[model samples]
Target chain A: MGFELETADHPERLRRVAIDPLSRVEGHGKVSILLDDDDRVRQVRLHIVEFRGFEKFIQGRPYWEVPVMVQRLCGICPVSHHLAASKAMDVIVGAGQLTETAEKLRRLMHYGQILQSHALHFFHLASPDLLFGFDSELSRRNIVGIAAAHPETAKRGILLRKFGQEVICATAGKRVHGTGSVPGGVNKSLTAAECDFLLADSARMIDWSLAAVQLIKQLHRQNPALYDNFANFRANSMSLVAHDGSLDLYHGQLRVRDADGKLLFDRVDYQAYGQLIAEGVKPWSYMKFPYLVGLGEERGWYRVGPLARVQNCDRIGTPLAEAERQEFLAYAGENGRSGPLHATLAYHWARMIEMLFAAETIAALLADPALQGDQLTTSGQRVAEGVGVIEAPRGTLIHHYRVDDDDLVSVANLIVSTTHNNQAMNSAVREVAKTYLDGRRLTEGLLNHIEVAIRAFDPCLSCATHALGQMPLEVLLYDAGGAIVGRLCRASGGGLSS
Target chain B: MSDVFLLDGEQVPFTVGQTVMAAARAAGRYIPHLCWHPEFQPHGSCRLCTVKADGHFAAACTLAARPGMTVDNRTAELDDQRRTLLQMLFVEGNHFCPSCEKSGACKLQATAYELKMMTPHFDHFFPDRAVDASHPDLLLDFNRCILCELCVRASRDADGKNVFAITGRGIKSHLIVNSPSGRLADTAMSLADRAASVCPVGVILAKGRGFVIPIGERRYDRQQIGAAEEQ
Candidate 1:
């Protein structure tokens, strides 16, 4: 892939570099780098080419169909969309608070989603790069290679993912596109057998989850500089936190923390998200840049997902994860002195801790008798507008809908988790490209360093970019003469062949 | 008397005048199908059930079964065609599974799973369609319509109201209402009508009844579409 580059200093000279289709990530996207006549990096942008006009097309559909419809946005995080939309519907239907049974069941399903999604991201997607090294042979830097090299670890990963999927199926109805959550409440309750089946392996899942956390910690210990300095930059962080400031992925108020760990806002009503957040548009990408409302575009942009979640929250409710959180914060400094953790690579560590918390949360929910209650839904007069927000495995996900008197959706807006990280991802790519690619010859391994930076966020381009196509990664190099000096393309399976 | 035929090396029985799809269903074999509901007259519009019978391609839902036909239903060549058909149907309409209320139970989605169709394999048409919610008790999302014509037949024959019909042809073809007002609100359609439930996709849905069955316990979630019939 190629694009015409016009630099400020050298308007006459043109240089272009492109990564056509970024691999090992969900959906289609590419990275473009522009160099000036002096051979200095001029600009770096991650372009999301897929245009999913879900907002425009979903306008006329009934608000009740939203929860099910929006989940189709991403296969990887359908449950997040499902729950977020359902919550919005709950507001539309005038049931601001769900029945105890419905709330607990939805929370259980969400945790299962987070658990499975994190397991997949860590074991299947991220581990290959971390374990095999970014510069390793492309063939050896994937889930299959992990399976071959570390059989037991791979097995645990698969089983962990299976357990999470089983939990989702047990609660929601099906693994992928479950229909369990609805407006005002859930449609089904957990059967005793389903609960028992999950509990049977809960202990083992927890053990394996802890081990996974330890593994990431060890990886970080081995290469502190690489993990810390690679695309590391400070920015605002956002997540949902319980009233007590405990981590609450499923239900909580919105909280935003500046890079210095200062709380900009806390316990803000999610329905009031419009007042707290505003989106900035860029000509280059389909994804919108969302920033905190009061901060304006320049400083308002924030990071979400695992790292942001762990940094923004005070403590995780579960004991094991809370312990891990304490240890993780040591890297950022004690008592919030050094500000929120900005080490981009530490996202993997934060993800593992969340996995542990999900397992523990699942166990606690299973033991609650409320999970089996028969009250599945509440009914009331429908309202005209509603907003739903939740912490997807990636980060804070928002769904807002306005229905007409006919109950058809008249206006729809969604800010997915990856969109929240769009600005941060671009900043990270710029940093990595500037540090590694200024005068050095572009190589496959060097290009991979950029991909590695993007991978740390575990950005789901499908949800973020919304293209209904495949995009393979390509990297182009330009010399001072404004000519294509070198090129690298990623095959479908992520092998970097020049 | 039932006539015996060899289907994929299994001895299967078919009644005279019954189509291959019906015969296969009778023998507890599932040839992937959409728009060929058992209760309705065979439409054969979806063409998903095309199987090789005696070295020729024919729609299983319409082709009459004969004794010793030696039909090959599960061959790679036929599956590939079915996969292609499913992909085309996916791109033709906005069949976003995650947002579809009928997703788990939708016949088109189930057929795609049976055929192992991975990607849409073609550019998405991303067609713009309308959602008719004028009817207080019913919601019709035309975006997901696969043009199966099951609703057309069910409305005409079973409900006897002629509330629905197909208009246009080829890519321009779409489901239309029969009322003078050109809206579902003016039609005699009700939640109790057979046409309301006949849609295999998310075209016709009871407005307030969405997500009535929790995801895991839904019809297809418990078992594959034809799994119960297989048993």
Candidate 2:
């Protein structure tokens, strides 16, 4: 860990750190932390340079195309956008309650989406950091590192993600950008053959998901102090829960709980989410800071995603996941949901639990004959406005749309899950900067500590804003007066430059 | 109709009045086309059926099938030009196939695949085309219009309704409804009209009946464009 500093000759400047291409996350991002001459961390901000104006561009599109068109938001979790947009259209078309087949098919697709997306993040993206030390040599801290060092885990992860994709292909008609979910109902139901094929593969997926849960747990147990304290913070948790107060990723009322797992608000209809959630804009990043209106913007900032969903839900629906939940609850002692999630790294554990639950749910849906039913759609009196909310793999996703009498979308407001966790991610980055980089030497591997905190949230900055291009991981050091005093660039091909 | 021509070195016979495309069709060959439907008079707007006839580029749908004339139909160069033409049509309009109801059944998509077109190879127009949903049973999404004028031919020549017409020229050319309100609902183009199903793309659609045909089972799902043309 040595400096390859190229200075701009500002002798009075101490140092400034900027992490460009926040490596191994969902999309392109940069984190700039400014240190003053007093060696104090002056400012730490996460910058999303791309401006994603999807909500604005989607205006005037036919409500039906919204499901498929909105998939451009994030390649990883396009299904979340697809389904959220579809749910919104269901209301626009006056499809109050979907046919049994339609709802089951949609649920199946969603579970597959969560199962695949979570598996991808845990095994492909985050495992590199978790398996290898965050400060390990750059070459050995990616999915390749996991594959070389831990072959069985890598194989399991790959197989789990593939099976989840197969499930999606069967339900949605295509693995990528499937047009299954329409305005009123799903386009097609699963054939008996498709259902049986997924059933044959379900047990393996379940076993692999359980293994993932065990793997994360083992890692947590090995370093309890580090796992519990890394980027740990107190904030409100939000997610969608079923009518019975159980985990329901597809559709339900909003439930928000504090850090102690005490209910701040539960069973709040998401249609009135505007009354509860307010977005704050900062010129630095394109990502919006969404906070609860009741607490106001200052203290209203909350966390969503695996940690929040696990913390906020009363219980999971499936038997296997419910059992795992019991073991996870032990970590929080009597409270169960509160303390365990405060450890940001525990998101991996919660994510695996959800993946297992998704697998279990997929199996149950395959066995149900409703998937083979012919009643795929139903319609009633049309409405001019509709709201859809779903717990996407990332977190709670909200989509509100208003259409003219001609059924063309007149207005669209989308609150992506990644944007919801923007403030929390910034806080985590600030904590890492203070803890690791304030008075210490700025080195290559040490910078990854900040990225580790962000990876825990699995934040899709592409959804927060957008871009995905592989370039040198640049750290541009600036002076107090905003001149580039020093610079270090970690090239994408595993070389360093100054 | 038995006037014979050497088409790609194969002898293809045609009627005295038949064009190269009609002759190829009768002889169990396929000349990729968009605007030249068999049921209507050939209007060579979309140059998808371009071919080398006697060492000169010609529209196969309009070129007369003269006896003993050499023609190159499926040569590499001709297919390349067809691919370029298809790419141009694709970029000139908003032709997103993912959510389109006519995705698997569209002639433009089928022709592009048959020509082995990998990409549009041009920046998209991102055209802000109008969507008219005034009709109770039909939806007119103008975004995907390729200006092929099949509906125009079908309405004027076959259905006698004159419900649709192509107005303007070149990039500014657009399809319009022949109604006082200039809306599809204001016209008498019902589901039974020949113009209703004559669209080669998703410009006209039935309301409340999209995505009913599963993607894999649509017309071009299993059958390629060439095979469908031959049939």
Candidate 3:
């Protein structure tokens, strides 16, 4: 079952509260909770009701056409979907070939996504609380507030995001759903002028990002209560494309580790993803709760994202990210699993770490000089199944496809990051209720904490739900004497009422 | 019938059913276009791609090649047609090329220059229309539209969302968003969407980068953006 049972108050007590029309993240999702008789907690079902038949949609589409087609997945993370889908085709077409320069170029494009996405997450979504007070009236707390409160930060974040956009705009000819990346390699290569511009822009952003990190860190320290119990529950972590388990975001092997920091799977064969990971589907939602091999049900539940990647990687190559990781570990309250890090705090730390790595990687690539060479798209013929997995800002995004002899995609499957973390979020929500909600009064701060904790994973519901719908979060309560205790106040975020 | 060689220098075993443009792209030669998108039905309303096919003038987008066909995409006669078409489009719509954001990167501008269209052959239609800045992340400047119908095709074909359509007729014809509200803000639109990116001219512009990159540093400023098709 996709639902998790939480022991609430008394005897067989179950009440359904559905969160419909989920907002702030992307797309839609709904969560239904069944409360026990004592108003404690019963079963929590996270339903991804809307299903996009993309797998069926792409069945007859030519392999070469998959990239442009899959770009429809999400406007925000189109690059990730584009790259992942293209790489999957590359493997299927036996075009398992990308020049070293092409790989670096791909990384350069990927870095654009990293910068833009993290900026959007930090500035557009989460920064409202920091720039403006958390309780600064819902009507006033928005991107407009950030612009008014810390005008320079908002302006710089926007500029940085545009710089990243320009990098994509330069190479792919458009910032959004670009037609540059193809099966074997990139369609267009960057000129010296473009590369120079990208390098210079990224370098400046790195300076701004470091200072911003400090500002965020200070804010985190001031509001310890806001982030309390954020990391109380620790789950197994997983990340893909990290070579030698060192903060690799784009291309390499995958690593899965237990909560105790023990390596469960290292550099596992990506082609056999179906065998290694199994998705359990429930009638309640479209989101398939994925589990580790043979872990069965709740036993195999795991989490993946920035925190997971940082924890699983032995070291991040970049100096700043490495230092931050060290600092986080040192002050991690003895758990040392990157687990105790609060959701609100994780925003700045993970963002800085990612920013540091993004800058270092792009700079290294630009300095390589050979990246200015041939943009030839080497091709090959192949008829095999291929799987490409990369960490989008959300978490591990996997694209698996089977192609026919005619080079048309016959079958497709995608295991988005949000899906992987769905179960973990359910557990977190339960814990949040138990800790904050005490069945008494619903404070806006508690509601904000619940929403912030969920947003910490930076869930991209468009990637999760795939189809169009809404996701809403509702809360209900009952007294121990089998009497209605209180009307469940709704959680402060958007959700689709299903 | 003579064999036509592709610009990419690939010898695509001549197909009798397809146009020269198809053959060229199939051979890895990309021919840029305004009226020709792969997913949309072809409309040769924009005669920007006139080419010499087997010693005769032909539009590559609509003209299918034959066996043993020797077509010259770069020729004097075809270049003249391209210039005339571009100049006509310039004068046909309110193409304030100087004030236009699409000046450098515009396919209309690129083709006009490629054909050495130094002067407008016809009188320019300086039509006055209201600018719709209502859309959240996109801008609509009706004064700069070329009426290429790319936006229409993009909305209907690519995204399955037909948010744009051409209204009026002849010189009076202009592109309009789906709703009579005439404001993209009220209509169904999103930032970073395919419809927003489809406009060929400065009629629709992404809000953020209006004057940032400037005219010279624009993407198509360096290369002959629509040259291959013109050739």
Candidate 4:
């Protein structure tokens, strides 16, 4: 993409550079880079200008509506929100332990959901950036362009996503916004036909997922210096881990580790998450910043998602993915067995590994005779307040709720995955901005750099804001006097303007 | 008392004082209505049952059946008008189907599907309506109310509690609780009351039981409303 510069809005007094509607990302958001008279970058902020009040408005409603209601947050990863909310309601209904069949069905739905979402993000959205250089021509750098150049790769991505959707349909009923999982258990389990349908493609999907990881690793090897150093920094990490300390995406205790791989907290009950984490808000952005309460806001801000989860967890649950995780930890002959990988670009590799795990998990769940069991739900003593935490494809997603005696939800607190990574994304964008600043204004290369940095986390602004809007890249530069000096915008349709 | 009328070419038998809606239902026919319930007196509020009775536009829920009379129930022209009525009901109020607990079993949603209503075809009024969840055993979501008076009629007639009523006119029309505090908790309504489950839509529902019946197993889930004996 190229832009023709014009001082139309602010004459020769260049003050601000903004990338409005950041492109190839999930939702509408922009980057504002405040500059000084010396043309030096001052402050950079990623803002969720749209306000979505799902937290406030969710109150005074019946508790069962939650699992389906919250899916309105994001189309990409709705199953995560659905499962997280359902888990919270399970606690509300006093079903602390679910029947084996119910748990298996829910797990199957989740794996299908994460598999499809990761495939869509890696292939449909982020692949163009990797296949073509970040600074490649706008017209020639997109999914369509990639399809023209590498048809087999593009087809694999589509088929992989399709297989995931089919699994969701079998378990949840329909793909997007399905009502499969209820408070105590899922509505239904995988039928014989459904099991057959999924099993037919399980081996193929695992193969494709392996290929994707290999592809990203090869891409990283081509330019390790840029891949490793670009927008890289040391940061703390967090995710959910199984009781045995294996990678658990569906359910587990909360764990947090620092940059040097020091365990700050392990096996913290998610119900006590309120004591461990506190949320911070700024006036500019609607999205909130969440940090470990012990560390406070500024120092506690850490990274989450694929990168964070891989570094935080001890091992992957599935054998194939576990092997890849080991290889990834030893990248470039560096022993990461006892450390965290700080490269943001490694998120792609981590995501593909997770996808492989999901595929393998799907195969295991289908073979279980529990899919045909009659024990579908369970109940115990009820609780007024409940909290649910799951490792969403992005990272730790927390949903807490309190119900009145009447059973209407009185309080709701949702720390979405993207909200947890808010500070990390802002810092990543800032690092890219500083490195790619050529002179007075942002070039196409700088804009692409910012996009590539943000896209790795796969941030969903709609989910972050809990509102709806467009997504593309735009940067605004404002002088110290607060007047906007220069601006660059990339529309969602890949049109660049200045 | 026994009378026969031709409804959309089928012979429908009726008794004295029976409305077209009653006669049709008694004879295994479904006449769509928002305000009429089987166990209550007809209020004829929502005119979703608009029909051509002997070549005159009439509400089937209120129109008395007469022998040797012809009534057109599901004609294209009448359905067009009925669709417009349903559309107005939809856009005027918040009828979010996917998230509503009453989604799979709601008659308003089922009838809309029966009529093949593709879209609302008008700008949404989006009238502000507040939820009344004050009652421990009940939740009143007025946002989905079509002003059908099924709850109103059941409360006043069957339950003899007079716990509900409708006020205002035209677009300002709304459902109100017949209590000093204007909340269901203050009324005599209980989980056992017939008024509690009379809502043809999602307006009056019991607390803590949302989505208890999974979607696929709900009343209208497996078959179209028309194919079923009743909504």
Candidate 1 lDDT, B1-231, residue by residue in tens? 999888888988988999888888988899988788888899888888888899998999999999988899988988898899999999999887766668678878887887788999999998877778899988888888988898899988899999998999888999889988889999999999999888888889988777787665566778886694355
Q: How well does candidate 1 match the true structure in TM-score terms?
A: 0.80
Pairwise lDDT winner, candidates 2 and 4: 2
lDDT of 4 at B165: 86
Q: Which 10 consecutive residues of model 2 chain B have the lowest summed lDDT?
A: B206-215
lDDT, candidate 3, B1-231, per-residue tens: 236554423354446677777777666564545577655667776766666665676677787767666666655666676677777777766675533445567767776676678999788766666667666567777766777788888778777767889999876788888887867877777765677786767777775333334233666666676434333
Ranking of all predicted structures according to lDDT, beginning with the best and ending with the worst: 1, 2, 4, 3
lDDT of 2 at A6: 17
Candidate 3 interface RMSD value = 15.4
Give per-residue lDDT, candidate 4, residue B193.
Answer: 92
Any runs in candidate 3 off by more than 4 Å, and if so which? Answer: A1-16, A33-43, A130-136, A223-228, A333-348, A443-445, A464-498, B1-231
Q: What DockQ do the predictions score, one after another?
A: 0.53, 0.57, 0.03, 0.55
lDDT of 4 by residue, A122-159 (tens): 99888988888888888768778889999999999999
Q: Backbone collision count in every prediction?
A: 11, 2, 38, 25
DockQ of candidate 1 against the true complex: 0.53
Docking class of 3: incorrect
Per-residue alpha-carbon lDDT of candidate 2 for residues A182-300, written as tens digits (9 for 90 to 100)? 88888898878988988998988898898889989899889887887787777788889999999999999998887777888989998899998999987777878899999888778
